[model samples]
Target chain A: MTNELALAALGDPTRRTIFECLSDRPSAVGELAQLLPVSRPAVSQHLKVLKDAGLVVDQKVGNRRIYRLDPNGIGDLRDYLERFWGCALTTFKMKSEQKGQE
Target chain B: MTNELALAALGDPTRRTIFECLSDRPSAVGELAQLLPVSRPAVSQHLKVLKDAGLVVDQKVGNRRIYRLDPNGIGDLRDYLERFWGCALTTFKMKSEQKGQE
Candidate 1:
């Protein structure tokens, strides 16, 4: 469920940018808003979606909340892709061997 | 461009399902449609989006077109996620060390 949610959460362009920025380092909504074209409230909305998707988590630092990528959620996605990667490689090798046989 | 397009393409549930099926093996539209709830034309439409995103490829096999997941496009997406994984791991180590010092 988290994998599907994470994929849906990242479907939006703004959310992807926010995720990328947070990937670099944690930041508050104001900081993200400053870096992006969108407003602070918009950034907050996107963050909420990411948080709900389990792709992001926030911690209170002083008076502000800092957002960062959740490695666990990312790990789930990575595992999913890794399965496909391995499958593709196996299929490629089999195809090559079959071609050699022919 | 391909990365973003691939992300957007897979963002759709149906397209993701089709991609997953192709991950197992290549199949024609009728074969995919039989396994899916969608119609043959619908499967073709989703395949078109996947192809346009560079996430899927097709070849003429007899009278039918066989579709398969494109390893190159999947590789691009894998590369993108690997970067984030490395960054997250680095941050995790740094934070863990800081906590150890504290």
Candidate 2:
């Protein structure tokens, strides 16, 4: 379920751009907005979705909120994608085995 | 762009369910519909979206179309996620280096 949320959060191109920007460095909403084409409020909205999806985290720093990628969230998403590949390989293995039997 | 499309394609719960079912085994539209709670036409529509995203491929067998996970598509998504992690680590490294210089 959480993994689904992360995927959904990343589905939007704007959000993905915001995520990639954060990947380079943690920044406040205004800084992120200046870097991207979107407004500061838009950045905040996207950050909220990313936070809710567990893909990003924010910390209160000197009256400003700084956002960065959440390692745990990234790990969760990576694990999910890895499991998906594993399942696909397993299906292939089963098919090969069935062919051997035939 | 393709990765974004794939992510958007899987944003829905029903679509995710359909994807998980396909991960288990290749199945015809009728078979997938039977396994899922949705109707056959609905399944077909979902399949179309999945196919467009390059996550699933269909092969015509007799009068039926068998759908299975596309390894290339899965590979592309996995690559994108791995790159994301790499970028994060790079950012951390750069930050550490700057701190060392200071």
Candidate 3:
């Protein structure tokens, strides 16, 4: 998924809460529901969006599916932000130099 | 602005494009319109959202308003992603240990 999709997925407060819950530990839908104020179905729906955004993944652990944060997704977001940071610093430096010249 | 607001503000493709443009250089609304496919008013609208999200800041440069990326906003996004990365690593280590025990 694109970084935009990931950002959009995490844009929701409920989804961010669900993502934070999974960050602490891998969990099943029922467990996530218990941790969050949302219902089981709501958790499931949020999970679907998170999965589509590549922010989380699921693995079948016996009869239950476990969800956990995807490192790659987080890495993508970091990279995207880092790019902007680098550019911002560069622009800042350029502006500073121009001021110094003035 | 909250990170959620920033994320939601960047969720739109047009806003992201406008953000990318700003990263390259500070520009006025007319300049951004020239650089992007969108109209000056559309760029203005996107800039307002970006400003509200703390992703960008504007300063009056004579008769024009210049827009540029805000380092703090980029830093906030990086910090948010890094948190997920740290938790993911910790969870991975714990899962590995459990597997080893099993």
Candidate 4:
């Protein structure tokens, strides 16, 4: 369900870059803004997009807002893929069994 | 790498449904068309998109084309999420260490 949110969040090139930057180290709004071509407010906007999608978490350490990847959200994607694979395996097994009986 | 392909492939609602159909069992183009809301050609086109994205594989069983989910592709997505988590954990550890030193 929310996997759609994750995909759409990452659909943008710049958001991916911001997420990549966070992967290295959780940084402040100004810090991330300096690294990317986007301004501070834009970075904040992108971060909001990521957070809402459950991809990243926001922390307030003192006056700075630190953003980092949320493992649960990323893990949710893995679970979804696994479910997909599980469906495939079940199908394969059922088909092969039908063939054996025929 | 190939995940972008997977994402774009699933971006379409119809393509996702067609994939869901295959998840149950591999079926011919005509079979999929009958089960779906679209024409045989449209289903064929969606299957082509899915195949190119590395999400599904095709096998010719006699005169029919059977489609199934590619486990390797779905596994690749799981691995990608795991890598993303690894990056996040590494960053968290580094940040905590920095705070300890201060």
- Which candidate has the highest DockQ of all? 3
When only chain A is evaluated, what TM-score does every model earn?
0.87, 0.84, 0.84, 0.78
> Between the candidate structures 2 and 4, which one is better when assessed by TM-score?
2
Cα misplacement distance, residue A44 of candidate 2 (Å): 1.0
| DockQ preference between candidates 3 and 4, better one | 3
Q: Global lDDT of each model?
A: 0.85, 0.86, 0.82, 0.79
Task: Report the lDDT tens digits of candidate 2 across residue range B31-99.
Answer: 989988889999999999999999999999999999999878877887877786778866666777999
RMSD from true fold, candidate 1: 2.4
Interface RMS deviation of candidate 1: 1.8
- CAPRI-style quality class for the chain A–B interface of candidate 3: medium
Arrange candidates by DockQ, descending. 3, 1, 2, 4
Cα RMSD of predicted structure 4: 5.4
lDDT of 4: 0.79
lDDT tens per residue, model 1, B1-102: 777778888788888889889988899999999999989999999999899888889999789999988877777777876774678867877888999999
TM-scores of all candidate predictions against the true structure: 0.88, 0.85, 0.82, 0.69
Model 1 regions more than 4 Å off: A97-102, B97-102
Q: Write model 3 residue lDDT over A1-102, tens digit each, in one string.
A: 477788788878889888878877789999989888778999999999999888899999898999988877777776776774677877777878999999
Quote fnat for model 1: 0.47
Q: In model 1, what are the clashing residue pairs, if there are any? A: none
